[model samples]
Target: MHESLPISVFIIARDEADRIARAIDSVSDFADEVIVVDSGSRDDTIAVAESRGATVFRNDWAGYGPQKRFAEDACRNDWLFNLDADEAATPELVAEIRKLFAAGPPGTASFWQVRIKDVFAHESGPAPWAYGYNQIRLYDRRVGRFSESPVHDTVRPPAGARLGQLSAPMAHRSIRSIAFHVEKMNRYSTMQADDMASRGRRLARHRLLTEFPLAFLKAYLVRRYALYGWWGLVISTNFAYTRFLRLAKTYERELAARARSDSGAA
Candidate 1:
């Protein structure tokens, strides 16, 4: 018989004192265990988590995946729910999770896809709330760990692990300001460049013209970012530009290094 699981809610944060409280409040009702792993935050983030009765642990700054993986591993429960400090669990979702646990532990359900209510800076149309943007938030800790991608870290559920969906929606309130976007791009782009370099990919120049434009069109126009009007357009454009900048900057650095090597060899 599968043993009943103790559901632990974990969040990895850095300099998120302003938003961490909201995230914690959202899940406070349903979560049996709330764990917050902070990565060298310069703000009162640690204090906020501690105030909420959450188990707070402070560590040096690491990449997203590694930080989350560390937090997950620190959890003392069998079942884990990974939440960002900017994301909140809706009351409806909380109730659903409670019911799920009440019916004994989830044995076959190793992973679950929960809907994400992606709130934008300006609510233009319907707020993009629907049956899409699902993420594997709740999962069995034993299934698989989070990928150590410095940029976009993700949990890789184990093979043959049953995946389910929850009716409740997880509200994402992080991607609001332009400042956040810029800083995130700077950090993630650098990480991505390092990732590509590790793979030994050759430098390519044409990527500048090709990748940037396409990224802008795909994210802004094709993805209906126009629906949100100017702000959305700006956000989408920046999103695309960030990706381009990552590749372009990395390629340029590699090329310069190669030329220096060639000159030295001659």
Candidate 2:
């Protein structure tokens, strides 16, 4: 039976006390092993996870890519399900996952991309694409691992690997309030800027003014974000703005460096 296949659920978190238990509980039904890799959390996240029978490991803060990879490598099973502290696995998803392991997925199959249901405060709607939500969360661990990006890390499967989507959805509570969104935007924007800087790339003015606006329009209007109403508007606008801010910060740094170089010649 697919249920007999060794499956491990791995989570990487920090200061996620408020939400970690929900994540653990959601997967407890099907997960053969639940491993939590925490990056020096000061809160009760560790205790909560331990109480839920999760094997908690403490490591210093690493970038998202490295942190996730570390947790993946630690899993005892060859099949890994990577989840965030704020995300929960729906029963439908759990059943589908169990079925896949029973029949044994193809050798060429590397990952399953799960659909996400985004819930706003007291409201539920489809997530805008700009929210960067569609993600590959389940995979055969032997084929490949996640890339080592400081932010927005992606799983890279081996060559000729096939990707598929699951019918069940992963419930995501992304925007608890406007304040929650703001805080996340601020944190992620800084991480993105740092990532670009490390890569020796700067955002060009043309790209920012031309490309970003079009991207926003495609997400908010063309994607019919209006259907989600005001909350959708907030999601779209903030999503676009955060991207702009990340690139703009990178550009601003370049300008400062150029000015310093010119001043030195004078």
Candidate 3:
């Protein structure tokens, strides 16, 4: 067996019994402890995580950032790795992380970013030219913690903190199926809209006309989703629609506020 590192890997899950195992298994061999924070999953998520030897904690749903913060505090180690229930660390990524700690704790780097690529249900793995985004997944909790935004769940590294990047990629199984993807997007868009409205954000009326097309072009052309052909088209279209939906919902909230103001004046 490979020597385990003094790293605590945490995963927050909700009704993800089917995919959470992969996330836990990927880190099981090398991590000192695996922590799974379950937010009241109706399915067997807690049971499955326990079966895989992950210490499970029950927390009420409080948005992404808060949930992750809870998991960070629950970790026993100063070094923490955050993995989504739908994502798995590739063998290459696991090796890279091990190498970082081979001599001792990573030198001056307080956090490391990993490229996370989408693995569609139809595809066996990420394409050679798959589009991915970088996120800070491994970090010293003392130097950084996840932001508390309800809609944005990203780590906020302190100013001047040293950062490093890992070339290896993490596999993100974000899309279960076309139908499931749509449902998930709808829910996310609602949350995004509510967050925006609470922050007093307003959208120009003209944005309703241009948001979808602009978003589609960025996803399809700039993000290289076009490389996936028909699957790319479907993904891009859905991505555009989600963006448009958020703007529309935000605009609706603005209009309702205006109507209330006018009624009060009358």
Q: Which candidate is the best by TM-score?
A: 3
Misplaced by over 4 Å in model 3 are: none
Better of 1 and 3 by TM-score: 3
> In candidate 2, how many Å is residue 15 off?
1.4
In the range 1-266, model 1's lDDT, one tens digit per residue, is: 23334788999998999989988888877777789998889999999998987899887767788888888888998788889997888878888887888777776588888887666645421365222377889988777778887656677887777789997788887575888878888877887888788777775678877987888887777667766677667867897889897898798779888899999999
**lDDT for every model?**
0.80, 0.80, 0.93
Clashes per candidate (backbone, < 3 Å)? 0, 2, 0
lDDT top scorer: 3
**Candidate 1: where is the Cα deviation over 4 Å?**
1-5, 122-126, 129-132
Candidate 3 yields a Cα-based lDDT of: 0.93
Per-residue lDDT over 1-266 for candidate 2, one digit per residue giving the tens place of the 0 to 100 score: 23434679999988889888989998998788899999989899999999998999888877989898889888998788988887889888888887777767545467888887665557443354423356889988788789987696788888777898887788777666778888988889888888888888767678778656775776688766667777667767887787777877888889898999999999
lDDT for 46 (candidate 3): 95
Clashes of 1: 0
Show where candidate 2 strays beyond 4 Å. Answer: 1-5, 103-108, 124-133
